[model samples]
Target: MATRAVWRYRAIFAMLCAAIVFFALLPFGAGEGGVPGPDLIVCLMAAWILRRPDYVPVWLLLIVLILADVLLMRPLGLWTLILILMSEYLRRRVDHTEALPFWSEAGLVAACITAAYLVDHLALVLLLAETPPVLGQGLHALATIVFYPATAVFSQVIGVRRLAPGELDSLGTRA
Candidate 1:
């Protein structure tokens, strides 16, 4: 039974990763004056990280973000590292504040998104790369923050529900 549960976790993670890759490949006009692609993928990833950290392992997250970097033509590993750090932070917070109200969770997501954009912008500056306008970055982060609640709802609807305490203990021991 434990083995089956692990497989189920792996399968779901794989499906999410594939979805991110597919989104990356879509012709979303990600260039100048084009649609700044929605950060739906990150929102989804964050939702899973918060709801079921074990289901979304760090290595798998790294792979997805790396693929996103390559496909989206961004600087390799910049967003990947930033997102992994953000997700891990959220995962730790989940342990303490799982009972917090939805508004609190949204507030945390907003802060994380803001931090991610700031770090990304800093990296671009340090590397002497041309950074987009501040307004654009702000809008992108705002969109990501706005979409997080919907993504969390979608994840719950799709059966990525949090493991019960007993189940978490069992999975932890097995893993």
Candidate 2:
């Protein structure tokens, strides 16, 4: 019974992560401008951290983030570190009930992601030979900022599942 339930939820989580990667890869363009791709991990992570930690583990988070990096051709391991750090940070804060509202979670996720983007882009600018297009980069940041809260809203809708007590014992232990 335990194993079946575990596998069922694990499969669901995998599918969600896969969906995130798929959506990330899809060319969903915005009007005339570039379409804002769905940032699955950010939205999912925010909700999962607050409500479904038992289903989404650090390992899976790292894997999804790495996959996103590879799919986006970003600096390898950068997104993994950022997402994991944000998840763990939010996890600890949740214990204290720090993020009590949707906007609060959105704000936190946006700040962390923005910082990560800046740091990653700066490093690439300084260390890599290829120069990124400044205008496109700026627009991407603007789109991410504008769209982050909507992702959080969707996270609240889709990722808030209740876990039975002690059902999450293993998850807690791993954390």
List runs of model 2 lying over 4 Å from the truth: 1-7, 27-38, 129-131, 159-175
- RMSD vs true structure, all candidates: 2.6, 3.8
- List of clashing residue pairs for candidate 2: 29-35, 30-35
Please, what is the TM-score per model? 0.86, 0.71
lDDT of 2 by residue, 66-110 (tens): 877888787788657766877887776654444256676666667
Residue-by-residue lDDT tens digits, candidate 1, 106-128: 78888888999999999999999
The collision pairs in model 1 are none
In model 1, what is the error at residue 130, expressed in angstroms?
A: 2.1
Best by TM-score: 1
